[model samples]
Target: MRPGVSLRTKIYGLVITIAVIAFACSLWLSIDNTRTYLNEQMQSHAQDTATSLGLSISPYMDGNSPMVVETMVAAIFDSGYYLSMVLTDADGRELLTLENPVEIDGVPAWFIRYFPIQAPTQLTDINNGWQMTGQLAVTSNPGSSHDKLWRNARNNGYLSVFIGGVALALAHLILSSVLLPLHQLEQQAMAVTHKQFATITPLPSTRELNTVTQAMNSMVTNLQTSFTQMAMHAEKLSSDAFIDPLTKLGNRRAFENQFIAQVGEMQDNDLATLGLIQLPSLQVINAKLGYEAGNGYIRQASEVISQALAHRTSGTLYRTGGSCFFFKVASAGATVEELCNHLHEQFSALYSSHYSEGFANIIATSYDNKQQLNPLVSQLDNLLTRESSTTGTGLVYWAPEQESQLQHANGLHQWGEIIDDLLASNQVTFMFQPVLACEGNQTSENVLYFELFSQFLQDGIPLANSELYAMAELLNKSLELDKMLLQQLLTIGDFKRDVTVALNITHQTVHSAEFGEWLEEFYQHNASNLPTLVLEISETAILASIDSSIRFIQQVKACGIQVCIERFGSSFTSFKYLRGLDVDYLKIDGSYISDLDENPGNTHVIQAASQVGHGVGVKVLATHVENETSLRLLEELACDGVQGNFIQPTKKLAPYSEKKQCQYWPI
Candidate 1:
């Protein structure tokens, strides 16, 4: 209806219209030309045949014979060119007539009718004397011409349809190729916006598409780099906020968070063993050594302590203060004594060689199931005060004696006040007993030694070592107590002779980096001033953290310190562990040596232990040598050293200058 329309629709309509018009025009031109040519040919043939027939039939007409006329007409029709022929006289009556029709092959009747060819009819008048006589007619068949025209038109129509179909298919393929790259670019852009950083795939030949892909790839790379920088910045911030810059350990806040979490887990699992180790002499160490040395020691001690507790079942270590560290362990079903013994063994091995003098006073508290954390902590504080009074040489545990002392107290607050005062002021006393060489009745090497024993208040009031230790444990201040006692000894006691001072170590004290650093510095400064120190660890302590203890011992041994395992063979079987420990001495348990002569079994056990120690190149010292019989049996068993009431009596520190050698003291 409209002159101008959509190109696609117009193209379609125009193509159809042009094709139809072309077909119609071709049909008309072909049919007209064919029909005209055929009609002319037929007309010519009919005229020639009629003229010849008329000439031939002239003689017959002159003779007025019907047979002659019929013969002539038949001859013209038999020529195969004419369909009908007729001859007649001038009176308008027929003289002779011949009819013949042709059959065409492979032509439809409707096609023939649609494109029919008309042949011209010929007429002749026969005259006797130049007047009107008769008419002649001749017609020819044109079926072959009509059939040729129909076939030509069909062939041309099929050719037009084939060309049109091919053009349509090619157009669709070309359009698809042009739009495909655009679709791909769109998808890539969407992915980048969502932070996918996906790489763009190669696109087809469009110039604009290639440019877009290159731009997108560049943007993705830049964004990835930016993200990496941001992540690094965030990590730095997080470390600075939550970590201790000095020791690289978790700060108080972080430790508290972790502690609460670990406690919850321990409670949920129904674990029972909780112990604390306090460093009672860190302030003394720091004062003696520079702050740098102190910090180094703290760092080293923290590392060692962390390593010791590394294998602890559901436990974590915290750097609680400048010199304090704390840890908690769930015995995972072990008895209170068993857990304490285990801790003592493990920690003893760790610090036994490092700081022999400083480590001797490390105290630990173990609480039974019935004890709560608060009361146990109070008890440990009291024990520490009692031990600190004496020159700080012994490790205290929670025992019945401590509980009895607490029961006699006026009240919980009063006990706390008294304990606090004892802790603040050095209201404690220490008694040192010498460790003599076992070669002869005469002293071989003057190794001035002492075992720490605690006395509270003005040095006469006895405090239960076990109760004080338990109170420290409850307070989670074992490290603090250990450091305090060590500091007290270093500040108050005099060490000027060639002596091997032995001290106890707790698990927390052994693992402290601060302690480790202090030991290193102390050894360096006192290389010429102090005696060759020996550190004694309880066998029970060494077994709790064997690997950590081994490492700690090795480090301390490297610094020229001596290591010893005390109270050996007292707890569960630990002979196997003894073989692996690098120790200079093994002190036999007092229970095994108290009456060696009366008990052959005790003598046999002592003989076996002495043999084992000698085999490993370790010297065996017998403790609690009270009577002459016990001392004689120890000598017979090849004991290396002896310490007991029969050997010597405890003396005041000042009298050591006058009485250089100690004779056997009667009990």
Candidate 2:
């Protein structure tokens, strides 16, 4: 029964048990002493009474005065101390006797029965001039003695009970103070195991308990530090293991991990796809452009591919080799045809613009119908081999005619026509999401600016910007589309003054060296009418070719326009480029923002990234800050800015107004 009792209860119980035993002993001694002393007193009283009554009667015995002796007995009995008095002659003849039953008042009968007080009886001879006449016996009544015994025992018992109760209460109070620290220690241990890393302050006054608690605080601090470092190192190991050494894209090994993991998780009602884009001309490009230039071009092309597929949260891109890239998309937003077209449109033009003769091919395979990845991978292998041999120069979207690559050129032409029609309209839509300052900049005056999210209108509906960028790549009009968006922004008359807006740019816009030269000349003419503009790209884009990204960043920064990498850590990023690239901000991926507080894995990663970013003078901001809890946690992690629904809702794309009288604010 006591097994489930708490430690505090057990401590109090032990103290109470000892107190009860001591109380019992003390009460018994008090009762026993009172009884013994009472019994001796009673015996003395009986002897004195018998001797006095016998001497008084001896005078009467000498004269044979029976009436006098009887009178004397009556006097003694009426005194109320004796129970009875008896008398007899020398020859043993019966004599007159006086007796009465003794009854003590107030004391209970049961008490007397349990703790009986037996008084001694005494006998004396009544003598006449040295001759014995008769004997008298006197027995003292024990009623008074019994009453005193019970009163003494009960008073001592009551005192013992009161003292025991007080002692138990005091012991419990003391134990509570002593064991309070133990309760805290238990809680602290549980919290530490869960990675909370909490500490207990104000050590217990008990010397031993204080020492233990202090030690615990030190241990918990060390353990928390160790856990955080371990998490960072583990994340680093996973990332470094999966990333390509040169391009920083997911390596072949990473692709295999994602492939198998997705295959195991794919359900019958799942949408998963595989794609492979191979640059069969990497060696030729390297020979034409130096090996370093060739590696840079590969990285640039990878950036375009990654940006095109950024809409897929569960998909991954891998640089299988210097000339080949592979991707396995999960829960694709578009069809296999659309993916192939997008990849082709983005990378083919990018390759052509970089090398003397551009060459790239794309093959997209749908794995939803296939039950396993092994067969899908085999199919991709066959397509790559076929593309390397005789596939047409442009995009080969998977068509009904599987054996021939050019059989799908007709579909590609149709997509090209759609993109042509969309661009001809010249209408662009733009959205704004405020990048809230994390370091106490709340008011409009303190806000840095809103990030401008722009898209091209197609079929009377605004498609995502990546779609437009991808299509523009295939049509060789991506630079024209980017310029058109900037032209529309420059023409905005109602845009608030003293407020800056940042634009997220595409890889194709900057891949062509001619675009950088063109932008440098175009800005000289248009910089006067443009608002404060900050162009943004993804880390994947910059990592593609640092040389190109750096050249483009410097060209734009020279025009008084800043550059940033949005969704920063989604790809494999290296800090070495920070020294060369002049980026103003690094926006962390949203995936990490949503998981903070609940799991410190993202926190540790963000902390490590921010530390590095800060050391290089680049401000770190987090995107997708959902709630106050997440926002507060990011603040604690020392982020410079945050953007999400919690910070500000994204505004609808406002159409460009051409009529209002306005001078575009100074860039």
Most TM-score-accurate candidate: 2
RMSD of 2: 25.0
lDDT of 2 by residue, 3-37 (tens): 37777767767787778778877887787788889
Could you tell me which 10 consecutive residues in candidate 1 have the lowest summed lDDT? 261-270
TM-score, cand. 1 vs. native: 0.37
Clash totals for all candidate models? 66, 2
Alpha carbon lDDT of each predicted model: 0.59, 0.68
Most lDDT-accurate candidate = 2
* TM-score per model over all chains: 0.37, 0.44
**lDDT, candidate 1, at 117:** 75
Question: Residue 50's C-alpha lDDT in candidate 2?
Answer: 85
Off by over 4 Å in 1: 1-423, 440-448, 454-462, 492-496, 511-514, 525-529, 652-667
lDDT of 1 by residue, 170-277 (tens): 754765575566556656565543233556666577787678767777876665555444434433443444356776665554454333333322211133333455
